[model samples]
Target: MTHQESLYGKTPDQLAALCGELGMPRFAARQIARWLYVRHTEDPLRMTDIAAAHRQRLAEWFSPALSAPERVTESADGTKKYLFRTLEGHYVESAYIPDGERATLCVSSQAGCRMGCRFCATGRQGLQQSLTAAEILNQAVSLPERDKLTNLVFMGMGEPLDNTDEVLRALEIITAEWGFGWSPTRITLSTAGVVPELRRFLDATKVHLAVSLHNPFHEERMEIMPVERAWPIAEVAAILREYDFTHQRRVSFEYIVMSGLNDSPRHIRELTRLLNGIKCRINLIRFHRIPDSPYFSPGDEAMVRFRDALTARGIQTTIRASRGEDIQAACGLLSTRLKGGI
Candidate 1:
């Protein structure tokens, strides 16, 4: 028997096409969108707007296509890490962080990462599988605090640009009028400058962008992030400079401040020179040390000095707070240990 199609994460246009195949009217797509996203219904039978016969047909051939987090761990600081199992039976993690009135969810785009950044734990698992649009959206759709989430960040488990298509689809459903209808400004997709796809992401969506620039110098960055060899950080900066981010659309650089590695005056001067013309902020994140990792977190004084130095150079810089550290929810700590045959 053929497997039924999942209705979750499909765009309105895609749903319209599905409706055509199901012998339903085009308007049925919007109705389904309203039920699936607006109403957050997980069962076809509960869609009261659809006729009984149509609902029956839906139950037979279409599924609501949502998966709840298999495991959740809450940190002492109120950050929560949700472990989700993908269709491929591999696992990924999503982190929900609450800060007063603002809350953000860090969602994954792939089961595991392939970028192999030295400082990242997820990369150790290599590539298990690329997650579907439904899987990417499921993290947010199935969230207990979905209503309280003010922002979403694609900075969890994988290189978003590497899994560009599915990430793009999920983004469309997130910001589209017929879907969740979230503002593009509230979403940020971080990448280690996967140049070609990064350019496509800039052209395709108005959502904010964050470049992972741990080191300002070329050689040093390549040591940690192999992607730098393919798409140099300078080239990424050049491409970003071409885009207009003067208004609501913002672009920021994520700099994980490693104690003595990239927190020096020389790196700051080079960073200022590299991002000279680009209108973006620098978010200095403290490196969360992983097992067998050579990198160490910068002291609070060093982090503050780094932030102050960048600010003095006319770049808006802020030290991002470390959250969920006790639960291994900080940067570069998300992994299912899938490579360990778990």
Candidate 2:
């Protein structure tokens, strides 16, 4: 049996090529795009604009490639975590966080992560599989509050730059005119500094970037995040210096504050020195404790002191509010382990 492809993630150009192969009119591609993206309908039969025979032909070889979440857990704060099962029989998660006037959905790029950050739950599961553009977009498209979403972040389960191609494809579909047509400013892709793909991502899109910079010293960062050994934080900072983030496109570093581990004055001084030239903000995240993890969140005063110290050094900084902790949907807490297949 031949495998069927889903039309959900294909770009207008890609769909046009498919139309040529199928001998359908070129205009049908845009119609299909409107159906899948604007109308949020994946069923070809409901695409009345397309001829009945052409719709039948599409159905024969293609599936909508959309699936509703298998399970959803809501937090006391109203944040919801959606569990999605991939076509590959693996599970991934997406978090929907609604602030006063802004709603952000944290979507996953891969089922599990291979970066092996000691403090992250997703890293402990090891790499299961990289999600396709379809699977990645499904998190936002199939969302219950899809229309209300104000921003999207690739910060859920995996390192986005680790799966650059599919992530970029999803980014393209997200911001393209024939697709979701969202402003690049409304999207942010977080990475653990996969250097090569970082360069590619910078060149390809105008979306905001968030780098995981939990530690300042190279040796110390290596102790917690093994990616430091491959792509040092120093080198990542240097690469970032080559780009321009002073305008609409912005870059920010994600720092998870641990009690006695990384929130010391020495770390703060080094962080100031490391980020000297780059015009970026530092987001201080409270570390969410995982089972048997030695790391712990610092006191509120300590976190504020760390943020103020960084702010005093000229880099703008703020403490990121922790959300969905009870549901394990906060930063560094997302994992599919209890949902079964590792």
Candidate 3:
């Protein structure tokens, strides 16, 4: 016999209809939604308030789609990287960093990636599949410290813009008052500036944004990130210019400083010129070494000089601290491997 679908992807109202179809009392749907979303109960069988027969029907027909990491590797610096399996058995990675009072979870939106930013580990893996809404939610819901999380970032595995529909749906579930109910302020979505969808996200949500802009010159950026070929950085900035980011919301640039590459004074001057009108901060990231990658992290002196140059020009800038370097959980370090099946 075919089993009834679980209520995972269903909204509170959709789940209500599911309860009626299962021959369950109507009120049971709201209770179940509360149990799954608010109470976070893992076992439907253990919901004792419901009548035993009704509970059995609910349990047998619908199964929860929660997840746990198949394997976890941690760095001594309090950084933990996880490999999670999707419903279809495809693997994805998320990272948790317990830094002081704030704990951040780097969530992935796709199984692999299609953006093909040459410096990114996920891009190297290639796009295997786009994650379902359930798969996307599972990353946050199944985190070991779900309640303690202070921030969530879509910076781990995929080009969120390519999977725009699912990413936005997942964001709605995250920010919707009836779902996780998280304030949009607590979430930040980074993109390589997928031109069209960037505006859609801005129009729909107030979540913060970070754009990957390693080099100001179109040709230079295109050399590292293949996405530059299609959506030029100039066009990305033009769209962003249409929006006001002076207050409330934030916009930042992610510039991975590679030694000897795009870190010279010439590049810096061009970068300053490129970002002159844009009211955004620049975050200098230390590029993590990966096989066959031509980039190398800049030395400490160079990093300091780079930050100072930006500061002198009245641009706010800071070098992002390197975390989980030992365990490969730092920026551009998450890659899924075949292991024990989930």
**Tens digits of lDDT, candidate 1, 1-342:** 134468887888988997888888889989998988888785789888888888888788875568899989999999999998877678889999999999999999987788999999898878888988889999998888888999999999999999999999999989988888999999999998998898899999999999999998999999999998899999999998899999999999999988889988999899999999999999999898889998899789888988999999999999898899999999889999853364
**lDDT for each residue of candidate 2 in 167-280, tens digit (9 for 90 to 100):** 999999999998899999999999999988889999999999999999999999999999999999999999999999989999999999988889888998999999988989
Candidate 3 clash figure, as a count: 0
Give the lowest summed-lDDT range of ten residues in model 3. Answer: 1-10
Error of 1 at 69 (Å): 1.2
Residue pairs with backbone overlap in model 3: none
Candidate 2 regions exceeding 4 Å error are none
TM-score: which candidate is best? 2
Model 1 steric clash total:
0
Query: Alpha carbon lDDT of residue 334, candidate 1?
Result: 92
lDDT of each: 0.90, 0.93, 0.83
Preferred candidate (TM-score higher): 2 or 3: 2
TM-score between model 3 and native = 0.90
**Number of the top candidate by lDDT?**
2
RMSD of each: 1.7, 1.2, 2.7
Model 3: residues >4 Å from true position, as ranges? Answer: 1-5, 16-30, 42-61, 337-342
- Give TM per candidate: 0.96, 0.97, 0.90
Ranking by TM-score: 2, 1, 3
